[model samples]
Target: MQRFGWLFLTSVGAGATIWCTHFVAMLAYKAGVPVTLDPVLTIISLIVAIGGTGIGFAVATWRQNRLCSIIGGVLVGAAISAMHFTGMAAYRVDGIIEWRWPYVIASLLCAATFSGAAFAALGTATLGRYRIPVGTALLVIAIATLHFVAMTALRITPLRLSTAPLDSTQMHALGLATALVGLVVIATGVFAALIDRWTRSDAMQRLHYMAMNDALTDLPNRAGFQSELARQLGVARATHTRLGFVAIDLDRFKEINDVHGHKAGDDVLTALAHRMRSEMGRHDVVARPGGDEFVAITRFDDRVQLVAFVTRIEAALKAPLSVGPFATSVGASIGIAVYPDDADNAETLANNADLAMYRAKSEGSPAPCYYDAPLDELIRDRRELANDLRRAIDENRLEVHYQVQASIATNEVTGYEALLRWTHPERGSISPSVFIPIAEENGLILPLGEWVMRRACTDAVGWENDLKVAVNVSPVQLAHADLPRLFHQIMLDTGLPPRRLEIELTETAIMADRDHALHVLRQIKALGVGVALDDFGTGYSSLETLRAFPFDKIKLDRLFVSELEGSPETIAIIRAVLALGKSLSIPVLAEGIETGVQLAVLRREGCDEAQGFLLGYPHAVSAAGPSAFIDGPHIEPLPDADDISNAA
Candidate 1:
């Protein structure tokens, strides 16, 4: 019903424009003596105008489709021409009013041409309501073209009549009346156009507001934060000022939300946003990028001032938030990266700040962490290493260095563990920890893992001793559904015994996707390949995970082995893990045994196997070294930078 109402209104508007255009042109016609309109005929012409317009509106908008509009437009042009000619016939003079036949034809053509243009303008969908002004103007042109051209077709001759035609004064009065009504119609069109424009502009403003703001907290969102950060960064760079890019995350916010409902979570976020804003200066920017995450751009004169500001914010955030009837307490972890000190651009600054925040969260400290230069260096070096690793993998520059694993009781090399070794032409030696994560994240782990597996199988086939080759598989690789199939294909192609090719995984990897990991591990076990749970005792629910999977070997994480000498608690944990492995009938291997002391402890603890620097450094399969395993080995642990040379 509302749709029809709008259609009716549109039809009336269109009819008014046409009627006014024709009448005004009629008023402009001066026959020099006297002229009047036939009242009945004039009324008939007005009805024709309204009726024709209604027909056009009904058909064009009936389907609201392009084809329908075009077809309706043609019919509308014919209706407009018919109405113009009907109005022309109503014009009265002292005698019969004649029209020049050629001029009449031209007038009809003009009416159809302009009326079709007007219909096409209105029907156009791409000309959004924003084009109302231009559309109205086009309609005006259409009406004017039809009316004036038809008026030009009139040819009147002076003649006396006993019925006394309307005088000059009466004619002028009619003209004035027509002009008044015409002005009103045009005015209405202009007013409607302006209203449409304002409406569209208002709607656009609302969309922009929604885009830049968080709906829940009414604070600036991530997009808004990036915009503000860039602006501030520009200002700081121009003025030589150091701007602090602080990334803040509400700690344990999930726990609070889980305890309460989501509505309470919204209330807490709003409260936190208000608190953050309250602590900001006019120039500072505070925004929420995501759930319980906030970023602020602040100015500081020096590092000390920045530290003081962070302290003030940390203290402010410690206060409990009153949400509904409950007071919810939440702490904040903050990371600060100084512009012109840590990074000059917005993205780098935001990333550095986020890294610092994670570092602070990991430390479990109350204090905020500031991004230091060494962290930046570490990240830069890691990025460079990742690039080099990609190239190394592509060019077959990566070497499969084999390290010896020996029985704890016999002190004889039982087998060799295949390790990926990269000696960059520029950086010399890059550790697996440094580049393996890079490989995982960049999706290079798949091909790299495959290469290592194939190389291990190929190398083991050529070994003088019928020893097994243990290869470490990344969590990324373990997640692949086709890993077992790929492993089977490698063994089939290399002709290496599946039992001799052991695939090692950390507990983190298995637990990452339990169902898929279990499925893949079972598939590998079905192929008669050895499955070792590497870094067993470190991850969560270690014992539970151990009982879940049928692992052939359990390699203890190096952390426990490193602390074995100094900490009794560490010794006790290792003993417990060893005992658990023994009870489960899964052989336990102690990794990172650097000295005879650690080996002696493991031997007494009933460790089945051990491997570390004390066993031998990882070397090329063809290289002759003590990698086969040596007994009674003793040496102090090397520093981390140099330890990568020997430590597996």
Candidate 2:
């Protein structure tokens, strides 16, 4: 009944109104003889009319079928006929009254036919808004026809005069009282209907609000954001104003969840959401689309204003936040795209902003990046490069180039480090610095890394001299791939001795997942392959890293070698590393030896081995002939700057 509250109110109102009208009409009738109505029968008739009509109204509207409506209407007509007959039975007159059966049957048929037609009309689509009024008018006609026809059936033979004859004035008073009471009952139902309508409207509004908001952060969700953005864009277009869309993605949020728990991550996100909301301007809108991502819309007049606003947001976001008992700070990469400037539509604008955000993430810049045409082109180019790299791995078109690693004291070649080189059929010799990152990002590094290891070992096994071959392993490969098993298989397939092969990795690679990477490295070490830490001083917790892994060699990053002559700090770091290597019984190799002086510095500092342009440029084993002399100074010119970044 609550679900159909309005229908319930309507049924009660209509039934009561029908019963009251019948009594009012009967009371107005001018009968010369005295008459009275039974109180018990009169009350009983009203109850029957209300109950029967309520059931009929509910059934008629319950289904859209015409048959159901007709059945319900007939039931209502029967109730009316029953009520009329029952009221007649209560009437007392000083005469013998009889009914003509034909007239009585006619009245019953008229009531049923007209009432069925009325409800059937209410169920018709064509009736539309006219259904209620039409149904009500038909019901009124049905009631009047039944009452008048049934009255005509009454025939009286006077037996005697009554002792108490009802006077006209007394009858008028009773009729007036009945009419007032009936009006009051009908009025109550109308008031209830009005109350129900107001309550329903309020409930719908609340439901709409819940649907548009985020439960966790109480921020506008994606649907709500899009609606507000479209409205703002319309206004911006009409007024010739600029609107900026800023996309923010939290960095290392996944790590936080992995380390502390998701509950801590949630607390952090909620705190950040509150801070962002507090920082927003009155006209600005901030929303969390999902996860650790947030988007904000701001109206600005110029680039200067936009920059200032973005700077403030960055500062506010970087503030310290509490996660349980501990306090930590999280950084965000923000990207911006402006209306009419970057894009005209919402989808394209959001996409451009996302592209800029990814670029900022790649560059690791503190400042937010704005969408530019070149960024889109760079993304397309990177995608194409990734595709080509995949094909290269499949076709074995990539090459392994080796640069000689020789002892600083003896100038005797100890080994060669294999560097991966890809010469695109069209682009020609794409640098490892550029494509290596792409490979790591797209998961091509696993195959690419394994291929490089296998090829290097195969080439080294065929060499005349017994020399260790070192292969660079990507951090992504080390963390995600089965490195120990892959290397073991490669060594077997290539017929290379495990002791003659070396695996080179950076400190950052081992730090990615210390327990797992160490577990993998230990497994590989058990196979008798030497492990070397490359780019030693460039990563975090250098001393801690050195203590954790038992390394066979430590390669100082080229950055320190380049600064050797100019910076005293560089020389001290080199000496300390070489001394540390000596104490640990490990060899220290310095890379990026461009001039003779850099080489001389390494020799005087007791560095064990070195590899750079001065020793030899990275030439293919097939080009250099694996047995080439190592003592002679290189006559060939040094590699250009583009080749320098490829230290793999």
lDDT of 1 by residue, 1-648 (tens): 756655665666676667767777666666665566676777677678777877877887788677666556656666677778777677666765677778767766665656566666676768888446655565566566666666676666677645555576756766775676567667767766776688689999999889999988788998888888888888887888899989998898888788898888888888878887888787887888888898888886777877766766776678988888888788988888888888878888888998788667767767888887676456556656777888898899988887788887776677889889888998798788878878875678999999999989998887655778999998899898899899999999999989888988888888888889999899989999999988877767466677778899989999999988767788888989898888999999988888767777777778999889987777786575433332333333334533332222
**Model 2 segments beyond 4 Å from truth?**
24-32, 38-44, 51-159, 162-212, 259-264, 302-308, 323-328, 339-348, 371-511, 514-648
User: Could you give me the TM-score of model 1 versus the true structure?
Assistant: 0.63
For model 2, the run of ten residues with the poorest summed lDDT:
639-648
Q: Candidate 2 has which clashing residue pairs, if any?
A: none
Please estimate how well model 2 matches the true structure, expressed as its whole-model Cα lDDT: 0.84
Task: Flag clash pairs in model 1.
Answer: none
Candidate 1 Cα deviation (angstroms), residue 384: 6.5
How much does each candidate deviate from the true structure in C-alpha RMSD?
Answer: 8.8, 11.0
C-alpha-based local distance difference test score of model 1: 0.78
lDDT of 2 by residue, 1-648 (tens): 564766656666766677777788888775667776677887777777777787787788777799999999988898788778877776666678899999999999988989999989888889889998998889888899989999989876667776666755645655775677577676866688678787889899888777777778988989889998998899889889899999999988998898999999999889988988888887788898999999999888887877877877788789988789878898999999999899999998888898788788889988898988786659657878999999999999999998888887766788889999999999998999999999987789999988999999999998766888999988888886477888889989999999999989998888888899999898999999999999987877378777888999999999999988666688888899999999888899998888766776677678888889988888887777686634443633433544332321
